[model samples]
Target chain A: MIEFLNSIQNSLIYKNFFLVLSGLDNTILLLLISLPVGFVLALLFALGRVSKIALLSRTIASYIFVIRGTPLLVQIYLIYFGLGSVKFIRESFLWYALKEPFWCGVIALTINTVAYGAEIFRGGIQSIEKSQVESGLSLGFGKFLLLRKIILPIALRKVLPSYGNELILMVKATSLVSLTTYMEMTGIARKIMAKTFAPVEAFIAAGILYLFLNFLMVQFVKYLEWKYNPHLRLNN
Target chain B: MFKFDKLVFGDAGWGDEFLIATLMTLLVSILSMGLGLFLAIITVWAKLIQNKITRFIANFYTTVIRGVPELLVIYLIFFGGNAVVMSIAKVFGYNKYIELNALTIATIAIAVISATYSSEVLRASYLTISKGQIEAARALGMNKFSIFFKVISPQVIRHALPGIGNVWQITLKDTSLISVTGLVEIMRQSRISSNVEHSPLTFLITAAILYLCLTTISSRVFKTLELNYSKGFST
Candidate 1:
């Protein structure tokens, strides 16, 4: 056992151990950039889906359908390689952001999650009772005020569980960013494996990190659920 | 002249290659879904019987498969599966290298991942079968097999159609991961085309359209099935 421990400690694979420890920076950066952009896009898409205008609703529906139909990896490839191939993108001012694998991955993941979250939010909005809107209007609330005070809050609460699931899925989906050469946990692990010839150990360590992150996400979602639904609170 | 004509039918065109890859993708997905359905039936049966050990095993399978990301599962199978297979083959006195096809391994990986979702859908449908109906069928001297086929199967299919449709979609999307195994699926073909042609946008967009075509058609068919099934029920 001591020999085994010593072997592991001395191996080049230990670089991956260090890489995994430092990989939290990439993961947090990905989440911070993608989440808010995804949320805003989701909201707009949701509103488009629920819009009274036929063209608006159809356009958003088609966008959601196409995004949901294709795999996230394909979207990433398209954004990273496909978009990057265009001379315009390369020559334009946006090239600085587009050139980076991290931003490319963020753009792809954000767009993909927005498609899913929009559908969930649309469902939540549609499920809201007509009586709630009636009450808001009866109270002389303006359209924006009514939506802010009544519609948006209720819809948000209703979609929170599905949104939580989407967030966790986004976390898992971020692993695909490694394919774009963004040195996230999986990328670092793959690099370590290539150098150290320890595929199993590198992947196992990366898997554990993912599992831990997912567990944290689940706990956070549960807390949010409880916090939002305080009326269900009973004697502890 | 050769360049322009070759652009239409050449190795670089990927026109033929893309079609073949799409066919392979469909083949793998269909085979995996079939395997998943067969496994799901047995799992649903075990769960339905309420045996303690069986229940524990079934629950464990679902938890692990669903809790972990599909990519990890695929990676585990891709990297470790061959070694296990070769060892078993060795015990049988096989002298030659026992080669496992990438398509077969991909099918197995996808089927295993899909079976978790399929089993849950089947289990839920199994439960939705009215207890009284089963008891009545038994009281009427119907055997277990007869009860299962004549009474349970149709209802379960009808009720589970939408959920099963979802499983089909999940399986279809999951086929993209098989590209990592070096299988010439649409994604892989597109990637190759992108690298060779240096026109990643064109090929990627084509691949996306192919996916959209497959999914849109299947979704429409499933919607039709849903409508047909719901026709008997009143509003």
Candidate 2:
């Protein structure tokens, strides 16, 4: 225990908080870009999954199955290393996107999250009664108007709890972006550890930062839940 | 673009190594699952004890571990574990440098992460057991051990099986992340084979297929267990 304390006192994590904080931008950037894109794609795929067309639903089902079945690390490696190794891909105009590890990490993270997020969205959408859609049509609401005014708003609210869980998971998952050699918080912690030989302190520093980030997120989700469900609040 | 012959056994191909590596991955995963369950039982016990400090500690373990990225946990164990272990060893009057094997390190790191999740499953399962059932068991003059063995455990196992199955799948997939510690698990082995064969696409897709099979098969197995345990009872 004393060793743990002494190591903390002697380490760079305590003395260099700003250096550790520097990696926060990359971590937040990855989340900001991927989460919205993933949610949008997830909603589209979830719609496809529930569509009347068998082929479209079946295709989306298989895609989600394969993506959810495999590890995100393998998916990341597949995008970063596997796709990059193909000769034509390397030589083609697509290399601009594939060459950067940050983009590769983003692509993999988005793909993986979309699969899980799609399932949540599907559940939320499915919970809505078919009567609601029919009623909207009877009232002369156009398809897109109905979606924007009713379907999306209700579905998004229904999925907020699960979406919050996914948000936390994704925040934690951004740490894996370090595997592609991207300088996220975890990657920065690794670099700092390598330089100072203080692995425990560096990791603790990173862990604390993630905990703080998720704490804020959880509170925001809680506030949203409270705001949107005033009837439930009144009952309590 | 495809070559099945490269997966042939013996020194002529990397197939044999891949098989062994797959087994290694399974071995680590199964070991970590068992260890995680043990820790989870203790964590749940601590929570149930109703002592403020113990409950707080248990909550801290689950919340902090779950919040942090798992890769960070593995990295801390891979590097910091050696020094911590050496220091404890020194207290036991050993002077030689003691390095933790990659297998042990991987198992411990993954087990710590797995325990936090499994504990949540288990605690909920325990909570699902009705308070009346325990009182009824006591009213029957059943001993504590007998009541726990007969009334509590059967219900807990049945309720918790599906959740544990999810945790088991997560643990299995999390093993691939430990490949960063230079363990010759399926992921690391795939990297080696891909580099040697210069066909990353083929090898990685093979790895993905292997994972898909493992997940599907194990999920089926969990389904069977759930069914059998649920046999004679209806909800």
Per lDDT, the best of the predicted structures is 2
In candidate 1 the C-alpha lDDT for residue A89 amounts to 81
Model 2: CA > 4 A from native? A1-11, A130-142
Q: Model 1: per-residue lDDT, tens digit, A1-236? A: 99999988886546566777577679778988998899988998898899899999999999999999998988999899888888888989888988999999889989999999999999999999999999999999998998799988899888898899898888888888888989887777777767776676677677777878888888998998888878877844
DockQ, computed on Cα atoms, for candidate 2: 0.80
lDDT of each candidate versus the true structure: 0.86, 0.91
Question: CAPRI verdict on model 2?
Answer: medium
Clashing pairs in 2: none
Off by over 4 Å in 1: A1-21, A196-198, B1-12, B91-96
Report the TM-score measured on chain A for model 2. 0.90
* Model 2 residue B231 lDDT score: 93
lDDT at position B93, candidate 2:
98
